[model samples]
Target chain A: MVIYGVALLSFCMLVGVFLGDLLGELIGVQANVGGVGIAMLLLILLSNLTSQRFSLAPMTESGIHFWSAMYIPIVVAMAARQNVVAAVSSGWMAIIAGVAAVAASFLLIPVLSKAGRGRPE
Target chain B: MSGDVLARVLTENSLIAAFVVVGALVMVSYWLSARLTRGHIHGSAVAIALGLLLAYAGGVATGGSKGLADIGVFAGIGIMGGAMFRDFAIVATAFGAELEALKKAGLVGALSVVIGVVLSFVVGALVALAFGYTDAVSVSTIGAGAATYIVGPVTGTALGASSEVVALSIAAGLTKSVLVMIGTPLVAGRIGLDNPHSAMIYGGLMGTTSGVAGGLAATDPKLVPYGAMTATFYTGVGCLLAPSVLYLVVRAVL
Candidate 1:
């Protein structure tokens, strides 16, 4: 049952990556264009469509949910690892950009909070 | 089986082995977070730090481009950790989010996204300039990274910036994400960051979905959905603006 869900995810991923590659080619970029985002959208669409049209087994639904939950941690770990390696080899500019972005966002909080206040709920 | 055959099999299926290693590292990172930070800092952050250390060590050991993947048996990490999976994970998070909740944030939430993207881009661009990155592509790419990690690479790829600049953008975004995860709870009360409306606004302002979600989870689990809702929009908005409007503006300035 869970395997079915993985099958669906894999199918979506395949189509999404295909389209992403196509889009990248069209746009003249040498990379996948939002492949993961497209796959996720496709999964959401298919899941919603199927749930409305036919009943899904509880196991099938849970299977999908399991993958969804595991998605973030795994992806984050991978990306963060790659990013750190890239940043280290790149230069100090990356470090400066990182530190500066954090500091800037922190400072923006007060300004944003002030603007958010006294508004009607 | 012969020893040579076994070695070949392991090398050929090394990616799976990499996954197992990464999973173990994640568990260890969580344990360290629980023991050292008392769960105050999110385990993901710790895991990332440990991952960086491992990556650095792997690079030093192998002197290869793909880090640990260059070690043969860990080659699966390259595919497992690729863009396909990265985007898949991001899109998957949206499945459980309710469309109705997005309406509650209304105009303020919309405005927050605009303000958040522009402010972050400006700050990121300024930082790029400070670092002597005068090119518009580098500046806008880093600026988009400040908007969100996803936006950074998308814009960089579209703009034809170098991979190094894109990597910098991602690092910048990750730093912001970690800080938001850590800072939200400590400043929640002082900044009046309570309730769904405030959470939506906070999410819009912060713009990092994971950071906003993690922070909201720490502040009040109830607020996670609302915050994530707006934060998701923030990513979309950033993606739309970064390569076109923001890139043009940076080009004009520099």
Candidate 2:
């Protein structure tokens, strides 16, 4: 039952990656175009569809949860490493952009807070 | 099998081995965060710092283009860290969200996302300008990064920005994520960031899902779901806006 969930996930990923690659080619870019995002969207749709049509076994449900929990940490670790390598080699502009974004976001807090105050809840 | 055969097997499975190594590193990072920062700083931030340090070291040691992947054993990192997993994680997070709760945020949540994306893009573009990046693609890509790290590369790639600029955009997003993780708890009380409504608004205003998730977890664990729900939409809104509307705006300005 758990294996079914994984199979489903894998299926979604395959299609998603294919579409992403196709999108990239069509756009004249040499990279995958939101392949993972596409896969996840597919998964969400399929899972919701399946759940409504037929209840998932608890084991299958748990299997999905296990993978989902692992997803963020593993992805973050991998992405962060790649980003650092890219930033270090890209000269000072990257660092400046990063710092500026963070600083500006901090400045925005006051403005956002003030704007948010109108809502009573 | 002989020792040579065993070595060859290990080399062939280097990618799996790399995952193990990364997992260990994550544990160490969490331990360091707990011990050193007393958990004030999220473990994700620490893990990222350590990851960056390792990446730099790997790059220096091998002089290879793929960072640690240049080394024989770490080559799997290239695949593991690729967009496939990144997008999968993002999409999977959405599966658990309840749609009805999202509707509860209503007009305010939608407004926050619009305002948040535009404001962040403007700030990012200004930073790009300040750094002598005069081109619209580069400026908009970086601005999108301010929207969220996910948006940065997506916009950059779509607009044909140099890989270096795209990388810079990611760095910009990462920096914002780390800061939000550390700053949210400190400012939570003062800014009235305690309730679910406020958390949803906060998530909309701050488009970085990881940052918002980590920050909310620190501030109030209960609010994590609410914050992450709207934060997910923020990314979607950003992805839609960055390359289209915001890019057009930047192009028109320059």
Candidate 3:
């Protein structure tokens, strides 16, 4: 059954990606099926790498791989526009964002740690 | 193309000498970073410094031969971060006063990452709308790719969205990649997510938002080449069989 489940999950993800293109075409949603496909491929590779020990449950890695692939290609497509990026690129922006991410990581990680206290899942 | 760039720079500028100089600096940096850590983490500063040395050496040695050295620098960065993560985790596990505290911290770290992604996207989109700007998507996409490829791709997925929401998904992706480049050693020093597989998974999560953000930023043909690979790789797994398993679990729990 586990084998069947893994096999079935693999098949469906592949088909969904291929079919997602057709669905996008039909629905006129402009979904980058190729990008989605790429996300899926990367996720599968990731799941395979990490799922051995930290896989909270069977197929957890696989499942996260599936859902995560859904949104990434869209982000990539947006990045392709060089002209637009050139107009807004700034040293300050980079500095600010870098600072912000670090600050946020420092502040939020610890806070979240505190909040999660006394709560057992 | 990257190889040619390196070769041209090396030949035209006599960069080999620079390599030796930088290699020495990197060694010193490694020693210093290690000393600074004071056993909080181990081997990271040295590893990063070594990696930097190797990068310079590798780049010079390979002379852009198949661009393997360039790729190694990126991988080395990720490996360093993974090593750091492993070190930190081990310390947390060994030294943590409460097992629950460690678990909570991990959960918090994960959630903050998620929240950060969403907020980044919101900021990105708003900036895009207000200034009538674009192009950061590529930065984010590439950033995320660098992150995931180096760390495992999951981290890229998680942080990718932060860039997307703010319309800097590509930058975010690239940032993650750079972070992997720089942070790997630091993270490795303090904690060790020593497992490459786990690192890759984390990389994927980091890249995910970047992918989404990249797609949202534009509908460009050129971006897809860089942007789509990570998305396709991660989502392809989903298409294969992963989602259904998730569905079953949700169903069972519900």
Question: Per-residue CA lDDT of candidate 2, range B1-254, in tens?
Answer: 59878567657997687677778877887899899999976676566556556766777887754556566767677766554554454454555655555555656666777888888888888878988889999999999987778889989988999988887788778667656765677777766787766777787788776677557655665565556555655666677788988899889999
Query: What's the true lDDT of residue A34 in model 3?
Result: 39
At residue A9, give the lDDT of candidate 2. Answer: 70
Error of 1 at A44 (Å): 5.7
lDDT by residue for model 3 (B126-164), tens: 333334444343233322222222221332243333433
Q: What is the interface RMSD of each candidate, in Å?
A: 4.9, 5.0, 13.8
Angstrom error at residue B83, model 2 = 2.3
Encode model 1's per-residue lDDT on A1-121: one tens digit a residue.
8778767777887887788677766755444554544665577678777878896677776766776576545543453335345545556665566556655655655566566555676
| Best first by lDDT, ranked | 2, 1, 3
- Every candidate's lDDT: 0.68, 0.69, 0.33
B184 in model 2: Cα distance from truth in Å?
A: 6.4
Residue-level lDDT for A88 in candidate 2 = 49
Q: How accurately is candidate 2 docked according to DockQ?
A: 0.31
lDDT of 2 by residue, A1-121 (tens): 8887667777877897788678766755444554554665577678777888897788877666666676545544453344345444565665566556655555555566566556676
